[model samples]
Target: MADGKNWRRAGYVGAGAAGLLAGNLALVTGSIVRAAGRTPAAVDDGPDPLLIDPPQLMRSTVAPTGDGTLLHVETSLDLDEHPSDTVLVLVHGWTCSTRFWNPQVNQLAQHWPVIAYDHRGHGLSEMGEKKVSVAMLGQDLEAVLTSTLPAGKRAVLVGHSMGGMAIMSWAAQFGANMADRVAAVVLTSTTARDVVQQQLLTPPTLPRYTEMVKPLVARAFVAAPVPLPSNELTSRLTHYMALGRHARAAHVEFTDELISRGSPRSRAAWGAAMYRLDVAAGLHALSVPTSVVVGSDDLLTPPLHADYMAQVLDHNGVLRDYVTYGGAGHMVPIERSEPYNVLLDDVLKAA
Candidate 1:
């Protein structure tokens, strides 16, 4: 009789605990959804404006993967002034196109050759395969390097977000010859793994409920509707997720435009892959001079990722530099263009 009573008591306690956890999880999810619908706080008019006018550049089409996926490549080379031995290749992040690098391109193209391209299923590029993975993105990048860059020329690769992940994937698969053709690498606002587990969607105070909430967060990304409505809610949500608290309305609009242009199917496909991403080995495989940049306020790919990446690269005999932007978010390149441009110039000159 005593044993039976103890067992009943334990069962009741467990059920109560489970109910509490479930209620908390529901609250968190509801909060996120409501936050997405709320209007974003307005910002004062600021002098920080985007560099909208880009220089006229040559356009070319290349089949990087040889899998019938044609990548749209743009280059601005003042062949009269600079040598063709080295070039700067810019890679944009997820849901973004070559246009994301316009500021950098406009600033750097005057001194050196600047090349930018849209990833598969982004911008002008056609979706090549039914299935998408980081490995496939790496293969596409390799194809771009092989076809667009001259035989003996080298490049300083600059990648952001998914673009950065693609670079890591490239290093993992093509690390053997990377040192020869790649002069330096810049990985901005990216990660090597644990993206889903360490995501900031759920509050850290709820450590006990993190595992339970992760799947819900991941599903939200994978199931997000395409051509997101152009409303105050959508604007607020984009600003919240991609930019820092100090972002202007104009900046938020620009980011929302790029994000909304992305294909819904492609977005979901890539989101699924990112949820399960683990490329720590790829970071170690990077043998060239590398710079890792992240915004301190970045919620998606936190600063811990940059710290871990720097640690791994240093351990593997690779000269690495880690930079953090205090008030910036995941969109470091756009949010802090002045510092970012200066950093890129320094890296390119060093390369």
Candidate 2:
């Protein structure tokens, strides 16, 4: 009888703790939303970038890979346009599809041939028998490079978040082939390593007591197969976690929907993979001109990560410029596309 009472008491305590966390999270979300109302004139008054649909239809095809993982590649330009020249390749981050690069693909395709691909198991693509890791991401990128780019053609690779990490992985693993195929590289809202330790959404103070606390919460967040249905709680939490001080309601919803679209198992697998990420060697192997962009309000891979990259890139003479948008967050590409596109255009011009 005493044992039963102890078990019941522990269950009640757990329930009470969860309830408390939920209530506090709600209040914090409200505070963040209210603060976001007073955004800067630059990001505040513009037409929503996320609403910018692709004016040109992108033809989709399966990019060839040696490992047999299916990578869905979308192209807006004719295959014959730049068979031997440089093309703009946009690689999306975790839980995002080729649609994530709609703003870039639409605008850049007018002059430059543009390509964006879905990561394995993220969108229309299927995960093959190979395990998911940063190294595999690199190999998959190489597959896309060889399959999509005709012989003699090079690409200006633009990778966002995990996509950027994949680029780093490529450079580290296939340094011998880096200069032969890639013209230049653009990394935005991403990190080379230690992604879990730098998350702003997870409080750093809690780790003072136990370092395990933060990773435990982060694992629960990325690995949990919770439907994350569109509701007040999910919306607010998404906004707080990713968007900046000036994020619009629509931006939050768009990002949330994309994240929730991934299957539970895929999300869990990739999320766990990030925890083991160690691609510092990849970042150091970058021999081509590389530009790093980050948002000041990015809660995931914060500016500290960018600063670290700048140090390494500068040392190697690969640094172009380190840019930080004051009011932007992790969704810098969507939240601040006009200026972001300008930066991309500059890279293309120099390349």
**Candidate 2: what lDDT?**
0.80
What C-alpha RMSD separates each model from the true structure? 4.6, 4.5
Q: Rate the local accuracy (lDDT) of all candidates.
A: 0.79, 0.80
- Give the alpha carbon lDDT tens digit for every residue of 24-135 in model 1: 6677776666655553464657534445757566555655576777888776645324575778888888888987886787677777787788988888888877588878
Quick one: best TM-score, which candidate? Answer: 1
Candidate 1 root-mean-square deviation in Å: 4.6
In angstroms, the error of model 2 at 300 is: 0.2
| Residue runs of model 2 more than 4 Å from their true location after superposition | 1-50, 204-212
Least lDDT summed over 10 consecutive residues: which range in candidate 2?
Answer: 35-44
Candidate 2, residues 262-337, lDDT tens digits: the string is 7777777788888888899999999999999999999988999999998999999999889999978898888788
